[model samples]
Target: MKVAVIGCGLIGKRRSQTAMEHPLSELAIVVDINPAAAEAVAAQYGCESATDWKAAIAHPDIDIVAVATHNGLLAEIAIAALQAGKHVLIEKPMGRNLAEALKMAEAAKAANRILKIGFNHRYHPALAKAYDLFQAGAIGEIINIRARYGHGGRPGYENEWRGNPELAGGGELTDQGVHIADLIHWFAGLPTEAFAYLQTAIWPIQPLEDNGFGLFRFGDGAIASFHTSWTQWKNLFSFEIYGQKGSLTIEGLGKSYGIERLTIAYRKPEGGVPDLEDLVFDLPDTSWELEWQDFIEAIAAKTPYWGAPEEGVSAMRMLDALYRSAKAGAPIHV
Candidate 1:
């Protein structure tokens, strides 16, 4: 697979590096509105550079198109590349909202091309091990989930594209909240109902929240809640799942988020103290590479892959309901 990555931002560079590293893929061209950015990345990887993403995607040699632009341009570029007979890897949230996500999904279906959403967090070592244990029935039946992901904003964050409502679609929820939504769905399917409250606590980006708190209700009284914020003074990532037999807790995401760690506890029948085990992943993040390899394998072998179109749509659907619930001040059926 020959790759053309549009947007030479931080994530775009990561995707380009992953594509370059993969044996089955070639980083053919790097594109960005800024020629300097594109040229820098292309120079680093020994690839072609272009300012026009449209021409790059239309090139017959490019087999895979990675869209890492802002939320506003993701859908347009992805749909175009899919229609041009190229597999697409879109960054998370799928699109600005559910409608854009649906259109992108439809384009992929119509074009008969693979459309994988970039959800690298699922491939983190601790999360991956926890998921393996979960599927092996280590946790038994799930009863509830609680997750929190947040980071304090840097200076001038309010001036970035993410702070703009039109460009970002929604604020914290659409940004980090979508990851939480997707992780929740991965652990416990889609929720039946959603309720949420959003606040622009400090960023001065009105109509676009800096903090979002959401609650979801699943079938059989299973519930999940999450808080994503730009107001958290300390960077954090925590996800906990409680089941009938035991519980799994994942904390941190390495680097500034602390060491990625997973703690497993088995419930005791006598109700005294449960046995506990802790596993720590004190290494660099390899999730991006893992996710790209999975995408490549899925393409070549026709195997199942995470962040499928339906899964992205479902996560966006949950986010859509969350925003609506916040607006209506009530729970909304999802």
Candidate 2:
């Protein structure tokens, strides 16, 4: 498939790396408002570059679009590509809020195109193992989950657009909590009620929360809780699931999610009590190669899709619910 990437930012460069190295794919075009960054990445990847994304979206040969731009623009680009009959892999948060996300999903549905959100953590071997164990009944019925993602607020944060709500969408909650919300939906399924507490603390964020705490009410009477911040000294993204017979913990960043060991404490259902198992894994295949390959295969097969646009919309709903609850100091129904 001929792939085009929009935005040559940090993640855009990383996402382009996979396409550059993939034998089955061609990096045909790259776009960014900053022509220099776009041109540099395009040259390094042996592709053409453009500052005019609208023109590139209309390119006749482009089969896939990777919307790796800022959160606000991803939905717009994806909608445009779907209208062009191109499949898209959009970055998370789907949109700044639910309304735009719903619009993007509607566009994908209308166009009959594959729309997958880039929640690559699903490919993490730690999470894969957890799913396997859960399916095998090793964990029994899952009862609770606790997760947190933290980092020293991005450099230049005080003066950066990331701290600006209009551009960055939100503070740590929207910036990073979207990942947690995606995980909650991915692992625990949708929830019923969600309440959150968000505060800026010392961060220079304006009209956005730098620190957040949330509680999710699952359908089965189980509850999940999460806390996250960008004010920490180091980056930390990790979660643990509590089940009747065992608990599982997965931790790390992009591509590193599966590199760490999967720690499990579970009872074997025999006479003995639960024990701990540490399973080390190689790094995750998060280079967009696996995701790209999968999307291409799915498009070719013309079968029922995976990670459809609706899933992205559902995730956005949860995020909006959490933020609204944070603002109201009460639980909000999904």
Candidate 3:
């Protein structure tokens, strides 16, 4: 399969490299609005470079189109690629909002093409193991979940694309918050209701918040809460789930987030300390490679895969409710 990466940013470079290394796909072209960025990435991988993404998408030999552009362009490029008879791997949050995501999903369905969302976090080693254990009842019947994820904003961040409402959609809520929402949904399924509070805090990006606090209520009576911030001086990632029989705690994400670790605590019937098992994943992050492999395997086998469009839509749906709740200052059904 020939792949064209349309967007020469940090993520686009990662996707291009993955496509180049994967045996099932070849990096055929790189495209960006800035010709220099596309040329640089193309030169790095010895592939063709172009400023026109549409031409790249329309190329007869390109079978996969990786859309890693800004949130505003995600839906447009993805729909076009799908209509061009190419499978697409789009970056997360799916789009700026739920409506755009739905349109992209519809295009994929109409074109009968695979549309994978970029949710590499699900491929993390510790999270993957935790998921396996949860599925096997390591944590019986999830009762509640708590997660916190964020990083301090860099200087001049207010001027970046993410700080712009039109380019990035909702602020921290749609940025890292989407990942938290997706993980929550992955573990306990979509929530029945959502409530949220947003704050600009330190960043000058008004309208677009620098911090977001959200709560969710599940249909099974399970509840989840998370706080994503851009003012947390230190990088952090923590997700803890408590179940009837045991609890699973995932902390860090390697590197700046600290060593990725999972702590499993089984409840004791006698009211004493429960059995404790701690596991650490010290390997370098290979989530991008693993995610790409999953996409390729699914394409080759014509089977269902992770990061499915519906999963993206569900996550976006949760985000939409949270945004609405933030605006109305009340809980909203998801």
| lDDT per residue (tens digit) for residues 280-316 in model 3 | 9998999999999999988899877888999999999
RMSD to truth, every model? 0.7, 2.2, 0.7
Off by over 4 Å in 1: none
The estimated TM-scores of all candidates read 0.99, 0.93, 0.99
Task: Give per-residue CA lDDT, model 2, range 1-334, as digits (tens).
Answer: 8888999998789878887777777889999999999989988978899998899989999998988887778778899999999988887768788898899989988998888887776666677677788778878788999998888776567687677676667788877788788777877889999998988887767678889888999989889999888776667778898888888888765442225567899767784767889887665455356666667677778765435677777778888898899878899998
- Span of 10 residues, lowest total lDDT, candidate 1: 153-162
Backbone clash pairs for candidate 1 read none
Instruction: Give one digit per residue, the lDDT tens place, for model 1 in 1-334.
Output: 8999999999999999999999999999999999999999989999999999999999998899999988999999999999999999999979999999999999999998899999899999999999999999998989999999999986687688898877788898889999999999999998999999999889888889999999999987899999999988999999999999999999999999999999999999899789999999999999999999999998999889999999999999999999999999999999
lDDT-better candidate, 1 vs 2? 1
Clashing pairs in 2: none
The candidate, 2 or 3, that scores higher on lDDT is: 3
Better of 1 and 2 by TM-score: 1
Tell me the whole-model lDDT of each prediction, alpha carbons only. 0.94, 0.81, 0.94
Which parts of model 2 have CA positions greater than 4 angstroms off?
A: 254-259, 268-273, 282-287, 303-306
